[model samples]
Target chain A: MDVLINLSLNGLATGMLIFLLAAGLTLIFGLMDVLNFAHGGLFAWGAYSGIWIYTATGSFLVGIIGAILTGMLLGILTERWIIKPVYGNHVQQILITLGLMLVLSEMLKVVWGPNQISASTPSYLSGSWEVGGVIIIKYRVFIIAVGLAVFLAVQYVLKKTKIGLVVRAGVMNKEMVQSLGINIQKVFMLVFMIGAGMAALGGMLLGPYSGVIHADMGMEFAILAFIVVVIGGMGSFSGSVMAAILVGLSGSFMAYYVPDLALAANMLLMAVVLIFRPQGLFGAKG
Target chain B: MTRILSNRMNILYLMIAAFLAVLPFVYDSRSLLILLSQVFIFAVLAMSYDILLGYTGIVSFGHAMFFGIGAYTVGVFMKRFEPETSYFLLAVVVTIVLTAVVSYIVGLLTLRLKSHFYAMLTLAFAGLFLVLAEKWRTVTYGNDGFTFRVPEFLRDRTDFYLICLASMVVVFILLKRFTNSPLGKVLQAIRENEQRTESLGYSVLQYKIIASVVSGVLAGIAGILYAVSLRFVNTSVFTMDITLDALLMTIIGGVGTLVGAIIGAGIIEFSHHWLTELAKVHWIFERWIIFFGIIYILVVMFFPMGIVGSLKKLKFSRKKKDSVPVKSETVSQGD
Candidate 1:
């Protein structure tokens, strides 16, 4: 029972991090029909910038904000310069974003040096709580809280605000949204920025959780995020959370029980999902 | 006009073949021969990719899986058996069969998906194979891939170079015939409009699977040659880098044009070689990938259709201004 609880908690934390990344990717894909392979680059940049800020300022909150701002800046540049050109052509988007992913990771090397950087949990979030013979790590709980908060905030904004309505409508039909007199391009840029910020936030949080961060972490996690997005169904927000948890729990459990199959477990999950329900758990027939 | 174009293409092929025939003796530099062989191997790989991406419009991100399958088969087989011509032949046969089977299954599972989903799923699947190669130490030797001996004939660099060049030329000619075939024309039609082809009662999935199998088999052959070229094989063969290299070559050279694959492969391999050499001169040049990325960006921005593709477009457009072209009529005749 204790082991199960610990695993579930660990899985939940990991899933939440993935959800943060996938949420942005799915929404961006939905709204713009652009597969931003460089989304992982944003995540890596976020982690590096956030961790760097935290170390410099000695304030974790400042670090987080710094990461978000860095992500938005990068996102704005990527959207304006890189992504803007290949809007509807997926092959071009994939190729260009892939190139950008390489550039981002290489730039991280150029900026941060090639060595992996070790990160520490902030003093406020360093301890663990023991309850009923089970120990729950504070950082994991913190990640879960942040993830839920972000999700709720996004949901509320998407549901209650006019801009959110416009964004949602854009996802449904870009032409219809444009016909409704909204500057769909502006919405696209905004959505891309928000999505990139979320990915960076995920990367920043992931740094301390993993206890060490590397430039290439973004690509590996981006693959996981893509898996979550696929499993949850593309363009579905709440579905991302659900699928991420599923992947995270499966990964955690598989790692403990069947180490040999652990790495393949998530891929197997994705393959099974693709074969049985290509539409995804929460996706419409798009 | 079409006859003139064909004659020009044929002369170009003859000239290239003549150049390759004399390259080994004229250069006499072992390094240059090795580099040319590598280019030939990759050109074959890129051509296989073009059959799918350019001809059928299936953008696969897991092509390296098939290539790795071919390479690993040879590596494992040669390591287990004596290095003999028969053993090499056996390895090639096994690699072909395995790549064809695997690609057929993958294509069946994935070809149904729309663009982005298909690409992502293919990547995920390839990642699974990479992990398996890393974990299955008993067979794959883990990340430190094992080296094995080849036949005596293959041990000679000139012999290997000639063989590789011959294989590339043969594959290119065969693929050219394939893309010009009636079925190939249908595949091109499917690329242009899948829904209309489906309405026309062509089984899009079947045609895609056929293309996948052919491409997979060819990639596997390239993998065998690649493995033999180095006399070494490792999990790196399965990396996304390999697939991306093929993709970049296909896109940069010319998507649908068969000759573009070779030119693209040459340009990329030569640039990589030259860049590495330049890295010794300047520390800043060590980061060659940034330059590579910049090239991709510029290509996408400016040469959206690729080098050969854009040139062809320019010529075609000019001809259109001169006279109404019957290219569409000829294409319809092929169908």
Candidate 2:
């Protein structure tokens, strides 16, 4: 029971990190019909920039803010310059974004040097607590809490705010939203920025969680995020969280029980999901 | 069919192949021979990709899986068995069969999905293959990989170079013929409009599977040649870099044009060679991928249609200005 609880906690934490990345990816895909492969680059930049700031300022909160800002700034630039030209063409988008992904990764090496950097948990968030022989890591708990808080906050905005409604409506039909006199381009930029920020936030938190961040980690996690997006339904927000948890827990349990099958497990899950529900779990029927 | 055979382009292709076939005999430059051989190998790979991406409008991120299968099959066979011509032939047969089966299965499973979904799923499947290769240590030798001896004739650099060159030419001709057939036209129709093709009584899924299998088998052959060139196999064959290299080659050369793929492969391989050479002169050049990435983005933005494709468009437009407007449509259709 203890081991099970611990595994679930670990899985939930990992799921939350993935959720951050997937949330942005889904939103960007939904509203703009643009699949930004360079989203992973934003995530990696977040880790590198956030960790650097955190180390300098001696504050994790500041690090998180720095990472988000960096992500948003990079997001704006990517959307404005790189993605704007290849907006309608899926082939061009994939090729261009993939090119950007490579550029971003290589630029990281240029800026931060071609070596993995180790990160430590903040002083306040370090260590664990035990109750009734069940030990819970504080950082894991903190991650879950942050994930839930972000999910709820976004949900509220999407449901209650005027901009949120516009965003939701935009997802349904961009042309219709545009016909209603809304500036859909601005909304796209906003969503892209927000999405990039969230991905960076995920990367920032992932630094301490994994204890090491590398240039290639973006691609690795980006693949996981893509799997989650595919399984969750491309445009469904709530579906992403659910799918992420499923992927994380399956990955955690499989790693423990079937060591050899651990890596294959999530891929298998994605294949199964694709075979059965091609539109994804919560996606509207085409 | 005879028109295609007697086309000026065909003569050009023949002349170029003839020139290349004889050049190595006189050149005696081992580096140039090796470099050209690598270009031929990648050209084959890129052309296979072109069949799917340009002709069929499919963008797959998992092409390296087939490439890796071909490479590993040869590597393992050469490692275990006597390095004889018969065993090498056996490995080649096995690679073709395995790649066809795998590509068919993968196409069946994922072709029904939308473009993005299909791309992501293929990538996941490739990742599965990579993991399998990594974990299956005894057979694969894990990430460290293994080197093996080749057949006696292949031991000579010149013989291997000629083999690679011949294979490239054969694959190119076969693919050119295949793309011009009625079946190839159906595949192109599917690429242009899947729904319309389906409404026209074609089984869209079946056509896609055929393309996938052909592309996969050819990619596998490229992999075999690649592994033979190095006489070694590693997990790197399955990496996303290999797939991206093929993608870049196809896009930079020309998407739907077989000739473009060859040109793209040559340009990319040569640039890679030149960039690495420059790395010795300048420390900054050590990180040449930054330049590669920049070039990729610039190509997509500026030359969206690629070198041959852009040139074709330019010529067509100029001819449009010179000739009657009605003739422009016919000329464009010829492309």
Candidate 3:
């Protein structure tokens, strides 16, 4: 029973990190109809930048803020320069973003050097707590809490705030929102920035959890995030969270019980979901 | 099919072929022949990719899987069985049949999904194969790929070059014929509008599956030739990099044009060769990938229709201007 609880907690933490990355991706895909292959690059950049700041300043909070800021700056540049010209052309978007993904990944090697950097959990977030026979890691709990807080905050903003409402309205019907006189393009840029920040936050958090950060880590995790997006339904925020948890739990259990099949398990889950519900679990029907 | 190449184009092709046939005698540079042979192999691979992306409007991210299947079949078979000429034939046959079957299954599962969904699933599946290759170390020898000796005849560079060139030509002609068939017309209709094609009573999925099998089989053949050229096969054959290379070649050459694949492959291969040579000269050139990425971005931005497509458009415009009154009809149809 304690093992089950421990595994569930681990799975939950992993799911939350994926949710953070996928949340932004799903929204960006939904609102803009652009597949940003370079989104993973931003995640990797966040990891490197945030870790650099953390090691330099010795403050995790400052490091997190730095990563988010870096993501926003990069996000603005990507939207205006890379993504702007390729809008409405899926093939061009795929090709250009793929090229950008390569650039962002390779540029990391140039900037930070081609080696994996080790990261440590901050003093405040280090250690574990024992409850009866079960031990809960503090960092895992912290991650889960942060994920929940972000989710609630995003939900509140999206449901109750004007900007969030406009973004949602645009996702539902871009032309209708434009007819209502909202600057859809500006909103897209803003949402993109926000999404990048979230992905960076996920990256920053994952650095400490994984104990090492590498440039290529972004692509690997981005694949998982894409799967989560597809499983949860493209453009659905809550769906991303639910599907992420499912992926996380399955991955956790499969790794422990059947290590050989662990990676294939996720793809299998996705295939089953795709076969049964092509639009995804929470996706809107076209 | 007749519309694909004009009499002038045929003459141009014949001249190029004649040049290629005699160039080895003129140059006799072993290194250059090897480089050109690599380009020819990739040209075949890129053309196969075009059959799906350019002609059928299906953008797959798992093409390297089929390529890998072809390579690994030869790699593993040679390692286990006797490395005889007959085994080579058997391996090539197996690659085609295996790739056709695998592609059919993959297409059945994935072709029904929307664009991005299909792309993601294909990537996921390919990644699965990569993992399998990595983990099944006994057969694949894990990351350190096993190298095997080819037949005595193939060890000669000239023989290898001629074989690669012959394979490229044969594959090109066959694919051209296939793409010009009535089935190819239906695939194009589906690309233009899937719903309209379906409404026209064509089985969209069936046509897509057929396209996938042809592309996969061709990609497998390319992979086999590539492996034979190298006399080695590794997990790298299944990498996303190879698939991206094929995609870039198809796009750079001209998506729907068969000859464009050859041009695109030559440009990419030659650039890579020169860029690496240039890298030795300057520190800035060391990061050739950045320049490559910039090139891709620029091409997508300025020349999305690609070199061949743009040239064809230019030719059409000139023809329209030459023929009075026909200009008005063509101008309105431009979009």
lDDT of 3 at A92: 70
Worst 10 residues of 2 chain B by lDDT: B326-335
i-RMSD per candidate, Å: 1.4, 1.2, 1.4
Complex DockQ per candidate: 0.68, 0.74, 0.65
DockQ (model 3, Cα): 0.65
Ranking by DockQ: 2, 1, 3
Task: Compose the digit string of candidate 2's lDDT tens values, residues A94-212.
Answer: 87998899899989988988999999999889999997899999999999999999999999999999999999999999999999999999999999999999999999999999999
Error of model 2, residue B89, in angstroms: 1.5
Per-residue CA lDDT of model 3 for A1-286, tens digit only, reads 8878878888999999899889999999899888787888999999999999999999999999999999999999999999998788776787788788888988988888778999999999999999896888999999999999999999999999999999899889999999988899999999899999989999999999999999889888888888899899989988999999998888888888887787789888788887888778998853
- Point out where model 3 deviates above 4 Å: B1-6, B324-335
TM-score of 3: 0.94
- Per-model TM-score of chain B: 0.93, 0.95, 0.94
For lDDT, candidate 1 versus 2, the one ahead is 2
By lDDT, highest first, what's the ranking? Answer: 2, 1, 3
Interface RMSD of 3: 1.4
Clashing pairs in 3: none
Error of 1 at A8 (Å): 1.1
Global local distance difference test of model 3? 0.87
